[model samples]
Target: MTELRISQKEFDLFRDFIYKEVGISLSDKKIGLVQSRLSKRLKALGLSSYDDYYYYIQDHKEEEIFHLISAISTNVTSFFREEPQWAYLRENINTIFASTRKIRIWSAACSSGEEPYSIAIFLKENLDHYKEYDIKILATDISKKVLEKAISGRYVAKDIAGLPKHILQRYFDIDKRDPQAPYAIKEDLKAQITFRMFNLVYDDFSIFKNRFDFIFCRNVMIYFDGSSQMKLVSNFHKILSENGLLFIGHSESLTRNNKEFKTVRPSIYERI
Candidate 1:
């Protein structure tokens, strides 16, 4: 039988390895988390120790390293999380609604799909009168596995508990097949959002071919250290239009690092 627990030395090595590879800093407090998440990998590889697993990952090809990240990255998300942000968007819809009839939004670091679905529902509701607007949401994440689920546009019923009844009725249909499962988002909403597996640490934004008018980057930045946060915030500013808006998580602040954006509201910034 292989030993499941990773030694402290091994944990440090793996932590440094991930940071060097992906700019994610795994603190000492996360040793248990790393062990819990990666122990399954060890068991799958039939490796007895963390050292063996580490070497395997180093020599392994792209697919194996991707699997390693998929195992460790957090994918926590839900429908209509932080209600005020949605309210904020609705309140100012007319101001940003342009003549192009095209609404472009980026759900950066969208996990398991809830956030982008929520965005789609919002557009279908508020922009219904404006037939000309082509609503498009670009939802991206580092995990290919989660991207697969996001593209499927299905959700467990409990995931929509906090969603408004009208929005729920309009955008989602109950999946009768899974009486106990969450309702799946309707095809109309799914068609408006595109799911792509992307690593924020190492992607060139030029391929997207356009600057986003609004970006919902939300909770994902908290995982990185100050430097990583700055780098991402700067990149966001660079990719946004002159007056584009950036919405981050409530707990996150950009007080010191990147000041290219002016605070329009709490956790909301506009490019200066």
Candidate 2:
């Protein structure tokens, strides 16, 4: 096996392709990162170059594009991440449920199901007759690979380590059958969520006819350029129920000039 290099031509091609397809902006600095990250896939496919892998993904469309996303995007997430948002939710939860027992939430970038599962666990702890409440969570991600793992409701022990023992005991089942994947989210938690493959950048939003009370699109917009971010925020405003809340990454902010939503907390915006 000879040493293969990703030429500047190859870097420019993939950079544009990734941005156009997924709304993620890659800088010149990420050329090394892209080459290093995607090289493994090229090797696995027995391809000689990055150009070949790019075309291979283009040809496969549904399956390999997902693989591309899996390779390119960072799916760094943990249970109960961004503590302040959860605290704010705790303070306002009853108000969130005041008008009706029915609740619909979309974990817009639910990587590996941590955010959605955390939402379920939060509701279960706070609400009485929680199962009887008409609650449904639509968990979507661009990566089919992660969605499969999410739908399987399985996790390794390290992934669940941040979770409290009581919550873990109540919400997850120990997978005695597999030592590799020791923690599986129990049926009670699994039943509340529907996992789907969705591309936030290109997918049709009209496919969702129902309004959600809250949409957790956290940590994802940081990857998008400003124009894409504004467009996504505007679409979220159109689909939320009145006074619906949008939670973003702690480091991300809705532009100060934007009229669609107002800040409720740091990283929390309410549809106006």
Candidate 3:
């Protein structure tokens, strides 16, 4: 088997394809990264060249697009990723929910279930009479692979090493059968969340009927260009309930020209 090398032209083809399909802007410096990641994919599909894989995806796009996105995108996430966001939520939970007992949250780009599960645990711990309210958490990602792991709600010991002991014991059922995946999220926590495959750039937003109270789209917009980011922000603004909060990645911010939201805190914005 010959070593597969992607030519500069082939790399540019992928760069344009990815940008048009998913709004992710891949720079010229990312040629090596793309080649390294997609090489295994090409091998798995028995394709010999980058051009072959590119054309292959064009014909089998519905399924292969997911694979392409998964190959290139990073899904690095953790429970309670941004501490200040949690603190802010804790401090303002009452005011945020003052008008209604029905709460809806969208964990946009929620990877491996940590973010949504953390929300459930946070509500259970902080909200007085947690069961009395109508709560639903919608967790979505572009990759089906990650969504499957998230739906299973299982985690290895090391993945959850930093969590508090009581929180772990109360929320996770110990799976003694599989030491590799010892911690499984109990039904109580899993019940509140629905994991789905979603592409923020290409998916139809009209499918959403209800407005969410909070939207967590952290760490994802950085991959997108300025136009894509603004489009996503607009979509978020439309779907969020009045005065609803949007939490973006620590490194991201809504541009100054944007007026649909006002900054409540660093990386936190409220729909006006």
lDDT values of the candidates? 0.82, 0.89, 0.91
Across 75-177, the per-residue lDDT of candidate 3 in tens digits comes to 8888888999999989989777766899999999998889899998998888866767999999999888889889999999777979998998899998768
* Clash pairs (backbone) in predicted model 2: none
Write down the lDDT that model 2 would get: 0.89
Task: Name the regions of candidate 1 deviating beyond 4 angstroms.
Answer: 1-3, 98-100, 179-182
In angstroms, give how far residue 178 of model 3 lies from its true place. Answer: 0.5
TM-score of 3: 0.94
Off by over 4 Å in 3: 1-3
- Tens-place lDDT per residue, model 2, 64-175, is 8777788889999999999999999888898778769899999999999999999998999987666568999999998888888889888898799878789878988886
TM-score per candidate, in order?
A: 0.91, 0.95, 0.94
Model 1 lDDT per residue over 133-161, tens place:
87789999887778878887777766777
